[model samples]
Target: MTISTTRKLVGVSAAAGLILALAGCGAAPTSNPTGSSGGPTAAASFKPCIVSDSGGFNDHSFNEAALTGMQEAAKQLNVQFRQVTSKSASDYTPNMQALVAGGCTYIVSVGFNLSAATIASAKANPKIDYAIVDDPADANNDGKTDAPNIKPLLFDTAQAAYLGGYAAAAWSDAHGTDKVGTFGGMQIPPVTIYMDGFVDGVNKFNADKHKKVQTFGWNVATQKGSFTGAFQANDTAKQTAQGILNQGTDVILPVGGPIYLSAAAAIRDSSKGTVMLGVDSDFVLADPSVKDIVLVSIMKRIDVAVHDAVMAGASGKFDPTTYIGTLKNGGVGLSPFHDFASKLPAGLTDELKSLQQQIIDGKIVVQSKATPKAATSN
Candidate 1:
């Protein structure tokens, strides 16, 4: 959570001085002032903009985390920034284009759904820097990423999801039920990637503990799973959660944006002692109302990545190289068990920590073909 104050000051000073100089002339400010004090006044023209996926900015998962990062960057770096939310897939391009037309120096597009739009925008405007989450911006729809202006902020979430799955299995075992499950908002790579790792982790737990833990929603072999059709459909998500719970699942991971809210509501209403796992951001921190039902979260650290990207762009150190979040670099990992930590079986937490290190050291490989590949070279 520590940010470099010197770096922040540097960016702020330059941007602030530009604003002051412009103010000295007859030109009016282009955007609202950041209202930062003492250090320097940020230039209204050096705005950073963000376009959310269909889930909007308050999805309480992926989109919210990214928006949080942008807000942090705006505050710490003393930059003016704005955001546009997308209500549907059709809104992606138009939202991004609006930000581009608004004269954003750096445009961050949240989620894989915006990949095509981001790639097209980056290609059309090479002068503006773009950062996209989830997808690598494979312009041709090929597996390889070739866009030089689009920086892909991806996560090896499988690493963290594996830890979460193991923890969930142990929790279920302690509860005397060997059933756990996971579902997604879509069958896309980002969503399936979490399910893949969760399944593997459960399988690993079964092998290590000699337990017959069963996962209900996702089938790793066939790459098929239950999905709510879209990220924002709480009713469908609730129905899906109820179905999984009916199958005796004591723990469930919902790998969608705000869909976790639906899962939380289901777990709460059922009153069956069932727990839920979260994705993208830590649910306990992001949605405290659901903390009682949330066991742990597979954190993608999207906010940190987005904040750092903004810092880099503001300081003129923007690199086109893709940023891959992994357990090795603190980019992606498991969140604290919170209220459930003390309730966990003895030695379970230690085992998860050891597994994390093992994965980082390459002793274990949390791989899934669904994982989006980072560019070998920028």
Candidate 2:
């Protein structure tokens, strides 16, 4: 019934190596799971829980992806699960404590904002197993997990964003604007990593094509740029988007949860046909309303990572080793162009494929100061 006893059953199920299929935003199962959902019902004591950041569970982005994974795992395990949403920074500790008080055995913290609370909760309640998405759970700069019970679900999104940036540059070049822009919700590592890769991707495009394509809203060397200050669809996010658009950028990549919605609005209102790139989840599929304007999305398979972590815990194989998602392992990738496939320049798709293989083959190395390195076991 405890995590200690669960470890004896580790890797007993073949489902441990199951491959995750790509999923978009859909009506997930209710937070409460019933046996009728499907699969073998786990022990009643095997409870898996999740806590969302300020964006809530339906932000059509990172939080939503993590929530969807937890829901699917609970359904497959056929056990009841709990989820709490934090409306602000102050809500993290209380939300985590609520789940602990509710007897959650496995906890998934949905974003970097919940890192401190998740670590503290794990240390205080050594019996519970924990996983944190998009954060390494290293409170000190020691390069090791602060809590042995906490697992880190991280993604190297810079690799995928580089590809998206290249595509954005190609789109802009074909449109004759030869300019792209990117903005984030905040200046955190998770958000800036995308900007770093995107700007580098644009630079790569310029080098390959012998053309000059300017990138706005972010400067990789200085590591400074415009941010909306929060991951919300607000006037500030819209205005930030407009500022980038005013720079004559033909394409824009918005790196935040729901803030992309604000960018889409800015693009629509401008009537200049400025395309955009999505971060976290596939915006075109996650939110069909933006399908017309989204050229591509830099995807981080958070759902897959979360599902694997929960399943591992359910089977008592809760290893705290850091799980780093990269292009080689299908952890991060670019979503299908969908509506923009035909609109891109000729041979761009082939060029992207070549570049992807090169990155995988180590022919091209994408560097970002914010890039996450897998934690070494202490």
Candidate 3:
């Protein structure tokens, strides 16, 4: 890949500053700091906070990605920030309330599970700026955010997932199986978007290669398939992955957060020779334990987006503009093949690059009903 194309693929340069700032990030503050370094004088009192979903910040997924951004923001601004981890859905409101009570100037709720609580908090406290990850915050289905204070941090993951799906299908075809599968954490829009893109990618591969590759877990037409119903790495997730693997699938895409761990375990135990795909964050780098079995990750630059949003808020530039991650920008794309690079088919890498450009050029439209609108792609 060329320099510009590599930048678009995984947002390496966009995230470099945040990664550098992470070295100076301290633990959650017991009390707010006195002043900030890289902001206006009024920003001395700016206190940003974050709350994680049930998966906590150690899920090696979106929650962790968001926390990384928050830490980087705090470090660069030279301010202390607070954080809360939710054990279940019920803790969302209470967590947001605690942050509000702590006099947080800007709060970020990580994940779609906290959308309701984020909207409620934003509505109740109009002075505070809020941002939500992986949700549009369209509580009434009116196709807009419910509150002005809340900024929607959404990702067009389907575009990147299509690339992943096509790569998986090609890998399976090269292995002579021509069978792939996918399962999600839940039936929600964020989860299903990946499945939808994967389905289309496999169809594209079949049409292009004139081969019959079967997708086992997800059915795009009926919008029904296997799901663990939760984003936990547990027995249910493992069993769901095993069920997909039992169908003789050569590759499987698990759409949940930490559920990919269970799928990785399933891949390791069985003799199916099945590889897995990751979502949100790169699994191979996030958790090296699954590096051997993972093919590639459909990555959304959540950390970079979160950092930019938090920085803007700290500098008194908070806007409710919806940020959409797409292939055109460095927002969403696939990770490198890593160890699996040598195992791929000869021309597969070049083909994926061409397809990515095609998608960016609007030649290949990866459609999904769950795609976010009014997108300010960055």
Candidate 4:
């Protein structure tokens, strides 16, 4: 008996619709249908495959999430998984093609950087099912890819960031240093989504309370300005954090992926109320010494996503086009505050929870360019 239920978590939400169209019902089958580390027992009928971005498989961010998802599917569906980690952008085409050539029934390209290559690879082979983890090509925003077989996973991170940002801004108001800062890995929409959401959350929090908290690299009215590209540089991130620190910005939100390490380091060493907000994976543990200086984090559920996609292909449910992961569906959310729950507000936490429910229920919309025009704003 196959049982499925869409659990709408109040604080959680990805791409199930698109994948359902690609695999069809006849792809593969296995006795053990839910993966749990037993390894694949059968080859099944359809095989699922994934090609990593230049960050490789263990970047502790998107790539890692994808791997976790695929592995889960492999165990549960008893389907074969072919995974290739790319060392550089040049490896995208070759790695993607290698999976296609290996008779993969479905192929997933891990990031937006692989969009062009996924397109060419899909067009060349008309029968294969293809997918991209972030950003869809075609530049038309027309809900169509260059190839009919490809599917895209686009996340509405603006919602998640809103919660995170709201928490950050409120934290500042109570502990009033009158300033905050932000930076991210890249300027691409995927990266920008985090920045945009962060700005929106901060603005909303301030607006509700009627305060003018000066922001570094952020303006909610026009939605612009941020700093330090790349998630790998410690020095640059440190310098950026230090600048915000000098400006009396006690809270520093750095969406710089793993580079948040630098920001945490600076916050811990500082004497003032200096603190850090993280993105993607939790940086609280990334540097436990800075636990006191750590704030909140915005998260994307990439691990579960990869696992489900691979399982979809194996289960014969792959569909093309874009798969949207939003708050209502349990694909994105805000991480716990860990040790900082002490200085946090009890009443504000309840308000954030209410906002999350309202946003997901169509009763309220957290401002985002990606959101549908019809959704009401909070």
Best by TM-score: 2
Give the least accurate 10-residue stretch of model 4, judged by summed lDDT. Answer: 18-27
Q: Rank order by lDDT, top first?
A: 2, 3, 1, 4
Please provide TM-scores, in order, for all candidate models, with all chains considered together. Answer: 0.88, 0.90, 0.89, 0.81
lDDT of 2 by residue, 124-205 (tens): 9999999999898987979999888999988888998999888888888888599899999978899999999999999999
Candidate 1 has which clashing residue pairs, if any? 16-41
Task: Write the residue-wise lDDT of candidate 1 on 1-378 in tens digits.
Answer: 122332232122222222111111111112233564543333455678999999888887888888877887787667668999999999988888898888898999998888888988888898898888898888665655556777888888888788888989999999858999998988888999999999999999999999999999999988877999999857888999788888989999998898888888888888889999988877777778988888888877677778778767776766877777766656666767778877999988778878877887799989987776767433
lDDT of 1 at 284: 77
Q: How many pairs collide in each candidate, listed in order? A: 1, 1, 0, 19
lDDT tens digits, residue span 1-378, model 3: 122432432334433422111211111212133364444333878999999988889988889988987886687677889999998899999999999999999999998889899989988999999999989888777777888888888888899889888899999999848889999897888899999999899899889899889999888889899999988999999999999998899899999888998998898899667898888877877888988888888877777678778878987878788888777766777877778888899888778877887887799999887787753312
Question: Candidate 4 at residue 25, lDDT?
Answer: 14
The most accurate candidate by lDDT is 2
Each model's Cα RMSD: 8.9, 5.4, 5.7, 7.1
> Which 10 consecutive residues of model 2 have the lowest summed lDDT?
11-20
Give the alpha carbon lDDT tens digit for every residue of 29-143 in model 4: 2224555566434335577888887666666567766776676667676556889988777888889878977988778788877888988888889878776777565544554
lDDT of 4: 0.65
